[model samples]
Target: MPTREDPLVSFKFGLEIEGKLTGFFTQVSGIGSESEVIQHKVVNSETGETIMQQIPGRLTWTPVTLKRGVTSSMDIWEWRQQVVEGKIGEARTNCSIVAYAQDNTEIARWNFENAWPSKVVGPEMDAGSTNYMIEDVTIVHEGVERVS
Candidate 1:
């Protein structure tokens, strides 16, 4: 008999910076990368058949977006300010995205290096609606690794 694999659910996750908990965000996205494809033509000496070969050129990392309910915390805002003031060198740091299992135990983790916020969008205001306000922060990083 073969055993079945149980996939971990993604609803429970948090962000951490330098081993400090940033927050358990409402949504996280864009944890991915792409490789540039280079095609080359190879001619066969005997058959004269041309073959198109695809090789990877460069790797491009995608920007990760984090979203959460609006709170009094100003950490994300302050981090973005550093970039706005041309202090990007100070802004870059390592952070981790941690995913938890059903019992709230960390099941997986992805770490980002040289990370900084590229954009921060505040929640929209509406006096008539009684919904929780959400803010978004987009971050770009030089590299990423799965720690566990």
Candidate 2:
């Protein structure tokens, strides 16, 4: 028999984009993939009953959103700018979301293929409030797979 263990915590993870360290991110969401289904009807000859059968259809990966406090680097913004300028092909790259253990060792990794920045949002400024400036970016990818 196998021994049971507790699942990994969510916060101890990291993000890497095209082999570049993305630094610390406050939030990472929308890491999902889904497939559509096609349905068909089948009829029973003797009982005169109908049944619906489903078949797998197209697959789609949801856009991933990454949020973090403002930094001096403009790498995320530069990637988005390329998209806005109709240079999508040059902007597409691979990304990895890695899970780290308590000892800071990489235990698992999810690799996203052909990813590109779809949108970028800047931090909001308020004169009366004091908070860390946060920026967010949305990334679209063709597929996502667990590599480890």
Candidate 3:
């Protein structure tokens, strides 16, 4: 069995997002202003070692299909609204990313389960708020034998 401190250990990864982008929005930065960014952060949950942190990474949404086999949830709407209105604490912006490291080398890629916006258009063409809802993030660790 692999110990927690082993050079290679298992990990679960995910992300958080907040705020919204509306119509006629122009790209000031990132993939595009309307485009959401999913950021990621990694830590050894058991050991508490900071593994990695990815910021301002892009996350795009496309039609759900059998090939994708996933659905977006409407869970984070309220929370996202609070975050955007400055009524809540700091929330991770959309699609920011981070990776994991082992023995000073990068070792894992984190991905999300859901791929659609949590918030929909509000009462009147208002850009709906979105809370960073992280789900089913995949953590692909480098196989031990592959390490040099």
Winning candidate number (TM-score): 1
lDDT of 2 by residue, 1-148 (tens): 9999787665565678887777667788899888899998999999989999998888989998888889898888888898999999898899898877767788878899999989899999998879999998888999998888
Clashing pairs in 2: none
What would the per-residue lDDT of candidate 1 be over residues 118-143, giving only the tens digit for each residue?
A: 99999999999999999999999999
Sorted on lDDT, highest at the top, how do the candidates line up? Answer: 1, 2, 3
lDDT of candidate 2 at residue 68, scale 0 to 100: 86
lDDT of 1 at 83: 99
lDDT of 3 by residue, 14-103 (tens): 222322311111111111122455556688889999865646665443321111112344434544565557654333323322223433
Candidate 1 segments whose C-alpha is farther than 4 A from its true place: none
Model 3 worst lDDT run, 10 consecutive residues: 22-31
- Superposed model 2: Cα runs more than 4 Å off: none
- Kindly indicate the candidate among 1 and 2 with the higher lDDT: 1
| Candidate 3 vs. true structure, TM-score | 0.19
* Each model's Cα RMSD: 1.2, 1.7, 19.5
Top candidate (lDDT)? 1
